[model samples]
Target: MHVVVVTKNTPDTAATVTVKGDGTIDWGDSLVVNPWDEYAITEAVLLKEAHSGKATVLTVGTDEHQEALKHGLAIGCDQAIRVWDGALDGCDSLGYAEAVAAAIRKLGDVDLVIFGRELADIATDQHVYQVARKLGWTMLGYVAKIQALDVAARSITVNRLTEYGTQTVRSTLPAVISVVKDINEPKYPTFIGIRKAAKAEIPVWSAADLGLDAAALQPRTQQLRYQELPKREGTVEIIEGATAQEKAAKLIDRLIEEKVL
Candidate 1:
């Protein structure tokens, strides 16, 4: 049972983010593991321990991404891997999927891969599904619970939370699943775990190491610029009436005048 959890560093929820005058984003001073990913990390660590298997947590980025890897390590992931390359600097989600799929292939025999339903910073789950597509593996999303996982039989059963309702799904191993935040309570790092994680050696996988072409890693989508949202301009007016019925009538008339009736 080899569980691979993919995670990344994101700005802390409480941090203030501002788009700079130069079209760059200033993410502030604090970076933490994606809040939603903490649940996936916890689930991966638990799965590894229950099956007595290896749990490897990985990310795609530079040193900043080590923040997430160490967080997973401190939470009990057996090993940490960082996938990166200079050629991947401005890549989009498609490029990210390629790199992640390559890394998973290099680690061969990975029974299951887990990811958070969405990234806090980027607010998208495209990379998760894209990686599964690139790997030609089952892709499950919004998993509220992993009901069962049998490494020997190469099978998994989970409860999916969707807009309609929860559905029970069974899939073969070597699949990729994105767990929702409610799946489990993410445990904080113990003092000893932190100490050990800080001392752990994490290897970085470059594009060449993953047998990827530099040109293929180029961005598919180009961002023209990031401009701040237009300032909201409006005025509030309180409807005044001597009676409730009168106020209701006035409100209706106002709605009709505004074409909102």
Candidate 2:
């Protein structure tokens, strides 16, 4: 089995967010490799361990992306590929999907493509589905558990978590799966893994290498402006009464005053 895991370089959630004068986040001091992509990497490693296959991790970003890629290798991916270029700086979910699909095509003979349910920077769960559409592959989203992989039959059976409950579905090989947070716990890098990852050579790719058109794949989403969240404030008032009916009436009056009723 040849598994390809799609990872991302995201801003650290622990870092204090600073808004610039223009209202966009100041990422100069922010850390990278947010948790969501780690889940994808962890799942891929587990799959490889179960089926005895090689796992490769890929990311779309600049040379700085290597930090996160190295982290993936340290976590357990067999190899790493970095897609970087000036043209890919502000690409949105759709553009990223196109670039990733092109890279996967170049990889050849990929059995499974896995990605985190969403990216922390964008918080959009659209890339995996878009890539699946472009590649004409079956896609499963919000997968919480992978029950079995029938190698002989070339199918995968997984349980997806939804608002209603868990739904088990089976799909043929060469499919794309977007994993949720509950899928599995990501493993920390071991001493040996870190040393191996440090020595691994990460290959870099450009738009031309991936057969992508920078102009045609420009971002469709426009950032008109970014704004800081409003500060929260409230006052607590306790209503004490002898009777339950009186307390209820007072609460209704307060709601009416606040125009929430």
Candidate 3:
């Protein structure tokens, strides 16, 4: 039983965002693991603990990505792999998925691949499906609960939350799944884990190592513009009346006067 958790490095939620002259986001020094991916890591850790296996954390980024891998190690991942290639810088979602899927294939004998529903920076929410397609594996998205996993049968059953209702899905091993935060609570790093993570030697793999072509890694999408939205302005008005019924009437009148009703 081997589980691989895919994660991303993202700017802290509270960090101020600005755009560079190139129309690319200038994320400040504050960075952390994608918050949603933490849930996937938690679920993978729990699965490994219950079934006796190893959880490997995988990420695609520059040296800064090592921080996310270290955090994954501190949270209980057995191994961490950093996929970095100069050709991958600013790669589109399709190219990223291709590289990630290639890396996963390089790590043979992997039973499960877990990921967050989306990355905070891009928020396209398309990488998981693209990875699954590239890998030719079953893709389960929006997974809320993992009901059962039969190692011998090499199958897993989960409850997926949908707009209509929860749908039970079962898939065989070597599948890719994206989990929601509702699936599990991520654990905080302990002192011992932190010490181990600090001393851990995470291996970095490049596109060539994964048999990826530099030409294929070029980004298909381009950013036309990046600008911070203007702050919103609003005016508040108070309704006054002698009685509650009168106040209700005044509110209705005001609403109709403003054509808001």
Most accurate candidate by lDDT? 1
Each model's C-alpha lDDT? 0.92, 0.87, 0.90
Q: What are the clash counts of all predictions, listed in order?
A: 0, 0, 0
Per-residue lDDT value at 130 in model 1: 95
Candidate 2: residue pairs that collide: none
Candidate 1, which segments miss by more than 4 Å at Cα? 235-261
lDDT of 1: 0.92
Candidate 3: segments with Cα more than 4 A from true spot:
19-24, 238-261
lDDT of 3 by residue, 1-261 (tens): 999999988889878888787777877888888989889888889999998999999998889888889888998999999998888988988889998899899999888999988998777689889999999999989999999998779999999989999999998988899999889888888999999999999999988899998787878887687877876777678888899999999999989998989
In candidate 2, position 136 carries an lDDT of: 93
Q: Cα lDDT for residue 114, model 2?
A: 92
| Full candidate order by lDDT, most accurate first | 1, 3, 2
Which wins on lDDT, candidate 2 or candidate 3?
Answer: 3
What's model 3's lDDT at 100?
88
